[model samples]
Target: MLPQFFPPFADAVSLPESPASSSLGKALELLDLFSLTSPLVRIDDVIARFGFPRSTAYRYLKELCDAGLLAPASGGAYSLGPRVIEFERLLELTDPLYRAGQQVLQEIGDPGAVYLLHNLYRDKVLCIYKQGPDVIEYEGRRITVRRARGLPFPLFQGAGSLALLPWLSPHRIRQTYLRNAAEIASSGLGDDWEAFRRVLAAIRRKGYSTSQGTITPFLGGIAVPVLLPEDRKLVGSLAWTVAAGAMTEERVESCAEHLTRAAQAIAREYVKVAADM
Candidate 1:
């Protein structure tokens, strides 16, 4: 479960013991139902599918809506809201590094899917870009960004998240990773610490990371960390996605190289911005 402290609503529901009272799970499931495929959903649909009490369903939806996590559609249906969009914008524009990275992303391909930078805020990775469709083919599949803006994801689920690992101090990394490790491991991720350590170490050495079949079953992700040239601390990462069928070691490597160069260029720009400051 995503920790509530990261987002106040994450922990609002109460779960029961016997047969798993399932209130919390149901609430989360309800939110998952409103993804790109079903962006606009009705409360009645949630009620009908989950068999949640009308009062209970409304209560959770109201809370989400109030928090700006959800918005009312025509006919009282629900969709994602502007709050997430605003937050994502703030995350990008507030950081000179990310703004620079966005520019690099725009220039990298022949109108391909672009990228945005993200940080692990409140335990979830938050997106800050408005990307369009771009494609790279491998193994009979395509790689591209699924959508733009306000896409919240688990930090343990992709190349971008791994990129953030090397920039943290060993102490901070141990603490933060340990705290979230159990939750991450239990959340259907591989339970191998050794493997995670290797992945992070490889990212550190290579200056980029790639993962397939992690966040989305048939999608691949490639990412590189933005580092302070002087201190080399990880600020965030620039990333894009690929379809599972398009995943190939060679394609992943190509993406990694390009993303690293872009990240370095952005880092250079950020350094100049800081120097001016």
Candidate 2:
């Protein structure tokens, strides 16, 4: 993996009941507990969640606090620490894709659309950077980008998420399809493997993906894969969302044209930045 770059994708797989992981890995996993519903965690929460022994749980908490990933909170609990903000700053400054995205977004310059930059993290799709229109809301409607950094969407959902499907290796694609066949069908990809392959093949040929209200009601998305110019390595995606009713065939084609141009520019910028590093 390249230092200061986005981490690569992981396979869609499940963990065993008592699988072995390093102490550091387990400590970092504690960050997953800090979500919308559970913003803080106590020692007992850690113990109950992971079945870690009392002493081991305390030790892990200490390690996390020392690392600046977690900090003590009111009433003997822990919350995500200030270091996460620092890391976000670091990413905005140094990450090639983000730096590139900033440039491409301003270049697009269209209002009433929710712009997004997505990257594959672990087994799910993550919206790393999101920006709503600055000038006005979408025709008197407020557009919200649904996928947050902490809350990831599945591989088979949304245009932004599904846009990444064609870029994965065949083996990984097969693995994901097998693991999520029901979801694939529900998303209208196909119930069977052959149909799933065909649908993705068409998406790969067209070089973008679009969906209407599949993930959010009355919303639609158009996404194009971003790849390294030289090696064609999949970086992530550049996508935008707008009112579902506005997406006629001509409109989608026009939107796709604009998105493809932006994605190519971002990919070229990423390549140049990577070379400089």
Candidate 3:
């Protein structure tokens, strides 16, 4: 479940309705409904959420299932299908950041730690890849590293997301701050724009950001921004997550150092590849 401090993924923005009229558009909309928190959705739920006529909703669902974009599950529900897996594999193969991240993860050589690669897309922070230990026990329940690839988060919330903020132009930062003021305050990052700017300035000075239980309780995160030297553009961020109980000051400092080093390595490789292309 998403913590109350975090907003629902669907509510990130209000999508324009111009595309809703087309069959292809509606099909894509159906796909958008599947998210980490609500993976399995029922036909009735679709009807209720979208207010589509029963017949029309079923037709769209049928089309998606037929095309392997969605698949039937037990109890008359549906989940994303095999084709989605194919697309994800293709993305990993094609995305340079993912390739660089794989190398960085291998170099880090910590199989017990969780690492994530994130990039900015359409003004949102998108998790591109996740690696490390598959599961960990938390509060007596086994928590698997949830599949986060392609999951989007607000750009100003978590440490990984905020790592990119320092590189944004002051105008863009101000705009984002005003737009998400309530959420920013609710997140405990800041209660006002000045406070928020100070937080980002601190990250800029230290070259990394750290937080405890900001995104998810009992999970501590540290992140460093990936910036290419030639253009001085922010590429993305490298982040590590660990159980809060294990987050000593020494551990946090070590994680920050590792992430900063990995970020530098990824930036160099990424810049070289982009130049060659």
Candidate 4:
């Protein structure tokens, strides 16, 4: 929402407006500058760029950090902290897509062993929503979801990654690919641009991807894209990891069908929720 100082022209013409003091406004503006692509920021950078007084900015920053909204980075920088991660987890837990998918996942075979993976713009697979299964037994093999954070896999290599790639703007997709190019190529995405482009093109054509040898060994990924109804934008990917030994060609087909259906159901829920807003 626009602040009173930046009131709509129509409102400004008709209403007597009292603009906020510069310091308060600048503090809020500083927070807005942090984003996925640039998460870490320095206090001096914020003050110089946003024109907030150093004292005023530090007061705000100190409160924000003490309240767990932000945290001090190494060398005294600041970044979004544990509180925001907690809030995001709360949102995902409450999200209708997550809730509906949870129920559907339960109804399908082997609910105790099933888990769901979702991807968002910044952190890739936002987190795993595990219903149960401290250790999954699939085809007589065990798998576990331990340490959900800091698992970095290319946004191009897994089904969740490929599912997200087509939804991003061409510029953003290219930027992300380049950002992780050297590391992703180590996973055999390809060594150079031409080869990487070919891989991305194939993912677009195939409409999904099956990535083996991604984050967890002996676990294969199956992903499908979910389209937001409002603008038909691809929001994120829905994927699950299946034990590789259990993923015969037939099981792979089943996974695709099941995951696609779940994606559609979740997308439908997202549309309804968005419309309510």
Q: Is candidate 1 or candidate 3 better by TM-score?
A: 3
Count clashing residue pairs in model 3: 0
Query: Against the unseen true structure, what C-alpha lDDT does each candidate score?
Result: 0.68, 0.79, 0.78, 0.65
Query: Candidate 1 regions off by >4 Å?
Result: 1-94, 134-144, 186-196
| Tens-digit lDDT string for candidate 1 (110-223) | 465546577666456766554556455657665555534557887676777767766666555545555577865664443654444554565677777777777656677788
**What is the number of residue pairs that collide in model 4?**
0
Clash count per candidate: 3, 0, 0, 0
How well is each residue in 1-277 modelled by candidate 2, as lDDT tens digits?
A: 2211212334555433322387777887877788779989999998888999999999999888887888999999999888888998998888898888877787767655677888887668888777665222456775555655445788788888878988887666766776778988988898886777778878888889999887777788899999888888899988888788788899999999988988999999888787787
* Model 3 error, position 91 (Å): 1.6
Per-prediction TM-score to the true structure, in the order listed: 0.60, 0.85, 0.71, 0.65
The predicted structure with the larger TM-score, 1 or 2, is 2
Which ranges in model 3 have alpha carbons more than 4 Å from their true place? 1-27, 53-67, 72-77, 120-126, 134-157, 169-175, 216-218, 242-254, 273-277
In terms of TM-score, which candidate is strongest? 2
Least accurate 10 contiguous residues by lDDT in model 4? 2-11
lDDT of 3 by residue, 1-277 (tens): 3222222233244433455678788767887678769999899988988889999888999999998889999999999989988888887776777777877778878877888899886568998888877676666866555427777888867778878878776656765775778988887768975677667676787888877766776677889998886777877888888877777889888889978888889988886665665
The alpha-carbon deviation from the true structure for residue 174 of candidate 3, after best TM-score superposition, in angstroms, is 4.4
Point out where model 2 deviates above 4 Å: 1-20, 134-151
